[model samples]
Target: MTTAPAPPSLPAHQQPGAPVPLRAVGPPRLRALDGLRLLAALMVAAYHYGGRDGEISDAWGGSPTHQFPTASQFFAYGCLGVQIFFVISGFVICMSGWGRPLRAFFASRVSRLFPAYWAAVILVTAVFALPWVAYEAVSPTDALTNLTMLQMPLGVDRVLGVCWTLWAEMRFYALFALCVVLPGATRGRVVMFCAGWTLAAVVAEAANNSVLDIVLMPEYAPFFIGGIGFYLIHRYGPRDTTGWAIVAVSWLLGQHYAVTRLWHAADLPNAFSYRSSFGIIAVVTVGHLLVAAVALGKLRWANWRWLTVAGALTYPFYLIHEHLGWVTVHWLHVTLGLPAAATLPLTVTLMLALAWCLYRFIERPLTPRLKRSLMG
Candidate 1:
């Protein structure tokens, strides 16, 4: 999201049976997470626009931008930002549900995700994709499937491709929702859930079924678990040393799994000696460190409140960026004859501005109304 994860923590005064609404739960927002959200969004943008030869040029009548300087491996590695998002989501979800009722947890998640997301979906489908049917011949079935954001696990396609992350987020929510269902049983349920899912992933790998691997998405589960461990440490502090050890192990597994998954995308394993490059390692390392720092209160200054805006823009930017920015890049570079230098930064700026507008006009305004309608 610029994932707009649920706010972390609950006020000490909030009682379990008090009927407090999720949004009304008085947790002081963790502002560092907001800044973290912004950073992850930028990484994904870099992945789409600057990765490899620059996926932007794929739209124009030319090859990837060899001429553009920043359009190098830096951008290519940015796709791992999605992994960072997954981990952050785990932290957000855990923190949001920490002391709240089960239903409140679900409601908070819905309010945070759906308002901005639904707005982005309608805009992208109607304004952009529908107009291209003459060439693309879109299927109504595929179109309808993505609206649920359940498409991937349901074996359907996403209306917006970047929305693939939502599918994973949804899965994480589905699994983590167990953590709240029975109140007293929440942690036990979550531990069992993660273990079962992780085992399923192992069996899928053993069976050598690529499809099954994608279906379970176990590789990403470690990141989510790591996030959970982080919440334990942040909330319980040094008393949760076991949580820290678990998180450390989970991070290692998550990074290893991430490299294997990313290599396939980059079409690696050509020689088999060393599959991943430095960029892959850096993305994994830096993302993990950032979360660790936040959990340990190392980035306490990030809680300054203003950074919330950056965090807020992340989701909309992520949703609209790939397709819209790609189209804009094509138009600017090919039609307007702009160079990559101008086109890339312009695309980023325009998308960022649009993301802010979405937050300002669509997200912030609709959030309360949507919460009342959907959660109330």
Candidate 2:
């Protein structure tokens, strides 16, 4: 008697009678991951607020070091938060997109990314247009281009500094959708994609190939790759050797790139520089271990309901936080003459409140409508 084929929804390599984890195939919500996302957003916000080079000083007529002496020291490390965000994005995207249709994947990404991003661009442009604000206004043409989220490739300046990460994310989504999702994400195919991408990254680095570097994202690819491996472990159990190996190799290469590629040694006045390879490696390692812990079920205790709300706020908060937060900090501290002690917390609280409003009034309402239209 012939045996029956495995279901299409299951990984291609899943053996007959293999025990698929309920957590993998069930509802995709992981509250701990949601909470982690919010933490990452807060880290980025802190970096923008006090750890940046000279923007605070430019706005308030005092050095950031002087105003936020103790905080700046810690916040300086907060830029690593973006790396953490990228890793989370990898796991979340792979989890959400596995066994999904290509069009559905595209629609989900578009609906999720564009609404708050458009709102942010429009709001930021208006804010910068105010004569009292210290920053120059983004021109109408640039603002229009920014709404497309393709301004980086079009050679137009981003209206918000944080939007650069969105470009990286877009490229990743496109690649993953085509190579993995379109073909159907399976254990074998995903493992191959991860391995191929890893090799491509090393080749790009060694050959100084700009085209491959742009497509492959040599510096950031390992985190994304590792995240995918962790998800595979979560879905199929940690017994998978290839998945665990992929994660290990990614960590090795990721830390190397984090130290060598991220920081500059020059002491330019307005440019941020961090030369501590140890600190860079440590931060990246910690980020990896955090996600790995989640995969291994060590963070199951973190699944609080409020983390769902926290996750919703992360995207919009990240989208609007950098430039607008800077403006708010300047307005409160410089224009209104509030002390730095008061300005910092006030700015953070106000940004969080604004993030909620953006999510509730804009993203929550628009996402479904946009998804329906795109799917239709």
Backbone clash numbers for all candidates listed? 3, 0
lDDT by residue for model 1 (278-311), tens: 5576778788889988888898876776788788
Q: Backbone clash tally for model 1?
A: 3
Q: Of the candidates shown, which would achieve the greatest TM-score relative to the real structure?
A: 2
Hey, what RMSD does candidate 2 come out at? 3.6
* Tens-digit per-residue lDDT, 1-376, candidate 2: 9967766654745542354342346754788888889888898888888876766667656767778877786777788898888889889899988877899999999999999988988898998898877789777888898889999878898898888788899998998998998988777788899999999889998889878878989988998999998888777666667778999999998888887766666564665535477778888889888898888788888878899999999898898888888888878987899999899889988998999999999998999999999999
Full-model lDDT for every candidate: 0.71, 0.84
Which candidate should be chosen as best, given lDDT against the real structure?
2
Cα RMSD of all models vs. native, in order, equals 7.2, 3.6
Residue 365 C-alpha lDDT in model 2: 92
